[model samples]
Target: MTPMLKHFRYLSTSGIPRPFRSIPGPLSLPLIGTLYKYFPVIGNYKFSKLHINGMKKYKQFGPVVKEEIVPGVNIVWLFDPKDIENMFRCEGKYPKRRSHLALEKYRLDRPNVYNTGGLLPTNGPEWWRLRKIFQKGLSSPLAVQQFIPGTDDIVTEFIERLSLIEGQNAIDFLPEISRLFLEMMCLSVFDIRMDSFSDNELYKNSRSTRLLKSALTTNSCILKLDNGPQLWRYFETPLYRKMKKAQKYMEEVAIDLLSLKMSIFKDRDENSSKSLLDVYFSYPELDFKDIIGITCDFLLAGMDTTSYTTSFLLYHLAINPRAQENLHKESVRLLPEWNSPVTKEVLAEAQYAKACLKESHRLRPISVGVGRVLDQTAVFSGYEVPEQTVIVTQNQVSCRLEQYFPRPNDFVPERWLKDTPLYRQGHPFLLLPFGHGARSCIARRLADQNMLILLIKLSRNYKIEWKGGRIDTKSLLINKPDGPILLKFERYQC
Candidate 1:
């Protein structure tokens, strides 16, 4: 037995604490462990079906499922909310999450271009240092409020574009929603309006187009490399090379944008309000490269995640008539008209709109669950989990269980609202779509504002109708819509 296990076994006198080795899971083989089960033609599991596989594992293994995904990487999947609470409680000062190791390698490979593997993959003191610099400006509701006008302008522009395409055949929603989100991120980060909605075919060459392609490529590569065999680590596999190229292109674009923004920011008057880029530039400790890294992280991180979320929200609203009407009522009360400004004040009063978004999050989380590498040892579900064990809380699965949410399969926005009869005060740790504590999503406030605004405006402007098959999710690092999000937007005759 290893020193840590020996110590834990000796120290834990309580009979309730189960041995870490006692965790039940599929039989793991040597070196490859359970990874062979994910191989093509022979493997039973697919990485994209992580959420489904997780649910099956929970039912079979009884919550604490242990699996060695690769040779040296063992993960303990926690399904119970109480165990999840203990997991977070064991998280020390700097919470470290295990993710995107391939991306981390790519960034570290290019010392000249990247200081660290931007925000998503980095952890420990380096991650904390960077997080602290960013938290003040990005994590606050007030900070997001400043960009409301700009964000709403893009929302209005996108809504106009939607109207022109409304009565036509069912529109594919993901690409269009992604473009809209990219436009919003660019405006907030660089103070530049990417005419992504323009009819001009030259939009093919727009920064938004290139950046979105690169971001998608990067996300795809990360999933393949991280989940596949460890061939990339030993040498440059084709997939690894592809990811490197995409990341390099993204890095180049970020650097160029940061430089351009710096020039414009210097020329602006002292009285002018700062954009998100300007705010990052103001930080004395952050150099140009730091700003570029962060800017790229912010843009890439938000695109697919937010777009998928917005797409799902619209899908739910499209199907659930009562919920849609309730949201529409709220939006009309706050917005009054289609072109009404989405100020912070307007968003604050949008109670139903907020609940709808939250409900969507619960139903379809962007990630299967929150991941954490504990710094201290903690017991979970009677198992004495050692420090540094990677624990993935099955947030999506837990939220769907009838115990946690009544009518788990149904779309019920009322559950989130305290005044409603459907509301149940479930575990605090359940339904953490954005995570919790210091390491929660930094873009939480901004993403919420952007999605809520779109939800309200879309509801107010059009009666959403489904136009395609039931939307399922396939994990691409984060859970993304598996099929085309086809929808019809019928303009409301107010």
Candidate 2:
């Protein structure tokens, strides 16, 4: 074992007090630190250097090793499931790190619901407040029930779109699925009909959406440098102008929707309990801009993540024909017909279908993991993590750990079954596809439900096979299939 791992193991077994165990690993460089090494190469591909190196570093340092990504930024990488649990329990004490370059660029000029704060990105008391408000909408059994029709409609539309692509045809599932999901998000959350697939104006002005989509995929030191005040001022070029224009387009779309929602709310009777926007507006003290920010947060978070995950699921299913058969069998047994809307009851019974999704997420999580900034100095194992230190748990790696999974590299849905030892010892925090802790994904239920429903519907209707008998996975902010997930769909005959 490496010194870092030895140190971590010692800390775990030793009865040392909190705040005393020194965090192990290398020191940061004066200014650029490891950023020059890690950031320069993370260009617009599927996986970040941080993620690639993080797994390598963990192998060398053990579960609780510390490393410097940049000067003064000490990142503690936690790989052990036990360590993950401890960190999650301490999450409120350790909130989300400040917005990074990409987030800042996106949010710098925008006004919407997140202006007040939302669950996935926000932290502190403000996050708690917004989460409470958002939870009321998401967690309400009635509200979730109400959302079913919209979700069903969108997923059905998505399957129909998939049907148009013939066998072995190379298609970019990224943009196509992104548009489908954005439509679903709007319909489900705001009762708004984006119909982006059909609307020319919406399609034409969606440059901001395109940019955001591209930003997530492309790698650039220039993009990173542009976020820094000093560097950004010195490098006022066309690329910067393009980003600014994109940001403006994004803001316009958000504001337009916010204004429309507000006008409708204004005209409605106080007693009308119709949409999520109406419910939110009922609370008179909350500002409209904040509402818009939070709503947009939902829109952005929901769209990219679900679409990317669904894409990954489709790719995996296309490649693994036996897994596809298992999924199809499960779907047929549970919801034999695809004509009806997928209900929670039907989804709950689709055991293998759910397992396939869980396994897919396990292998190719949207994010490598979530990051939490230490609110104050804290100790993990035998290390002192200073205040403002960024702590990241490798959920992707955890899913592959032998302690948590048997044959971690293989896709086996039966492994998640209740009687299995894997299920018994499974670490909730470690297996988080939606993350864990005080700032866990608020849209967890919605994202989960949507993915499962889409899978169930797709599997029942079509037998998905890969083009030329090969599949490739890629990583951006979210992991997805590299090429358009090319597939031949043989329609199921009833």
Candidate 3:
């Protein structure tokens, strides 16, 4: 073996002290860490073992375990809810741990949209400032209420499109739902419609959207391999060129939309009510580029997460018909009709539906977990985690711990029902689907409300079932069904 390979093998096998011995599960091979075992197994959708195997590791290694994949870096996998809370509590100081290879290769070259001051990517004061601004836009109860109609229209169209599918067909629901959700996000955030469903040049050939997807996909893969280039070289690559073009396209669209809105604002009577764009424009701190960055942030965040969660829920429901039956029955009893707005009370009443969503998220979080880098040396679980050490809190494993959840593997929504200890005692940090700390998703409430509306409408219209009595999941940025969710929709006889 080469000298570097020999060093990597020694670090993987013998660098750690006996007390911090390697956990009993998959064997870590020379220079490759656990990738050699995990990659092949997870590459197949039918036999993907990452989630299950990771959970097993947590059970064996306790809440905090260190794995030395390379000579200098030690990946500390944290599983306890308390530890997660502590990590998040240190938010600004403990910013997202930098991934040298992936971040440089895919993220740095991109214009600020993918790199925007939004919750997921930014750090320190910049992140806080953007989060504050976004929260102001998203927090207005009146503004959110105003968005309901637009969101409903989008979901209604989604239902209409789904109705056209033939009987007992296996179809991939990811792309369709993603497109619809992206449109909805655009409508709500920009107060303009892209109509992604109908062919439009902007929607069909959106260079920014395509580039954003590519960058995220490439980042995810390369980060896992730690094969990123140096900072200066990253900006000069072909990938970087694509990212820049995508950002430019996004900026052009944003500027045009902003100009149109500004004109309307000028034309309106002095007493006319302000829209979201009007409110956004009133803020002097934001420029055209900032606006474009935030807009792209909303689109990217909404599309992948909503579509993935929806797909995973469908996958679980497809496999567990009884859960689906219960959810449908609850949804029907609460809403009884699809034409009306879903009231807070009615949503609360759909206990099983909410449970199923939580259960799905617990099993398969869209991004898996959050990452943070220690700004100062800190001791965790009696081990000294030095400054700049990357801490990854595994949401999949943390949610499945028997202490926090009973029958974690099984599908049970009752855990979240009223008056239950599980409901009361569940740590908010542990149950974070939108992440935690100051950088959590700004559009979370809006997303949840829209999702609930879609579920109600879908349950009222169709009886979803698996094709050939089975469903499988595939991951490409977001976890989704390998094929579309196919079911027969009989018009509800009310």
Candidate 4:
């Protein structure tokens, strides 16, 4: 049955959709739904603060509980894997993930800046079309592999740069790695050299740094305007205003760079060594504005997630010395020579290293879970959910649950080894950090390669140890270390 028809039937049979309303959830007060039931609202300023207590919601509400962020929007949190399977399967060829309402507003307000939708907010045929074109650019195995030599040099140079930080006073490691990722991303995606450590380098005024600064502003705006009060939609709040400025800066810079590149590439003949920009230039169907939009999305995602994940892996290794030792053994055996280049085939040999990265991801996921706005009504966990409801796969909660994993609290990378009885067989649906189906991250391979190379090199050169007691995670757009992660690194002696 159609979700709309089902909803209509339920409404006509009863004054309201009792089945929908009957779903277990927090108390919903008038306009704000059940937000006030768990959060604080002081005067004009109101904060749902979901990021700080996201897992708590799953605990307070059951496996399939209703949450109304505002009057119209209803979010259903599903921890059961069965329900997640249905939702993912129900998502048609072009999966519909959450659309950033604030970003949509920006696109509407400035048609010139955001002429066409990019991956983040685009859906249906438009999303599918752009996704295919985008896949050809980044997702293709050939695309990322073509740049391996460049990516390897970038990582090797970053390790050299990282080594310079040794013997210095205890320092916050997050910002340091964030820069490395940013530099690597720029080199890979834009064909831009962004090494600030080079004697002739200028970071503050460089195009890469400028893009990073503008992206930070735009991201902060999206988080506030996207997750903030619904009332912000009516007025131009300070955040929205800042978002406009940031987006404009981003658009202007992108158009200028893309236009200049197009002009430069216009004179050159077709060649096999085309960069991503070159690939886009080859496609006559793509609009200049769209090229800018896709590039912007690349810049946005490229900045944070991989760096955050790498930091967490390092942290896990530092805290769990046994895991670190195990990884060291694996690294030494697979890579007897520490300075070797990491190709996909070579990376496949480093089983323990991959397991360590996976363990860190399971423990500290970037988001609470993957979200899919359903287009069809489907049964989830024995309940009939209506259409257009945001179904969240709370893997962050499920990954740690003892029911799915034995001794879920312990950081055991060996649990991922194939021969062990602890190895899970068929739970891909339960543990998706980058999401699943067609909507999975386009940069999955690129990000994975980046993290693996950096970690392998890092472990080879130094023994990482966490001096500060238990660090917390903060979830905004990305889940990351809450504060400065103080860790001690010693040079490995022969």
Candidate 2 matches the true fold with a TM-score of: 0.84
Q: Put down candidate 4 lDDT per residue, 81-129, tens digits, no spaces.
A: 7767778876767788765667667776767666665788888898888
- The parts of candidate 4 lying over 4 Å away from their true place are 1-18, 37-52, 196-210, 267-272
Give the per-residue lDDT of model 1 (tens digit) for 212-320. 8888888877877875676998999998888888887888888887878888998988787668878877889887667767887876787889999998888888889
Candidate number with greatest lDDT = 1
Candidate 1's C-alpha runs over 4 A off are 1-14, 200-206
lDDT of 3 at 142: 51
TM-score: which is higher, 2 or 3? 2
* lDDT of model 2 at position 400: 75
- Once fitted onto the true fold, the runs of candidate 3 whose alpha carbons sit more than 4 angstroms away are 1-53, 68-71, 92-119, 140-143, 166-168, 199-265, 268-276, 343-350, 419-424, 468-488
> Candidate 1, overall lDDT?
0.84
Ten-residue region with minimum lDDT total, candidate 1: 6-15
**lDDT agreement with native, every candidate:** 0.84, 0.66, 0.61, 0.72
- For residues 300-403, could you state the per-residue lDDT of candidate 2 as single tens digits? 56777887788888877888889898888888877656767788788768888888888888877877777777655555765666666678877887777777
Q: All candidates: CA RMSD in angstroms?
A: 3.0, 5.3, 7.6, 4.2
Which predicted model would earn the best TM-score? Answer: 1
Q: How badly does each model clash, as a count of residue pairs?
A: 0, 20, 5, 0
Q: Give candidate 2's whole-model lDDT.
A: 0.66
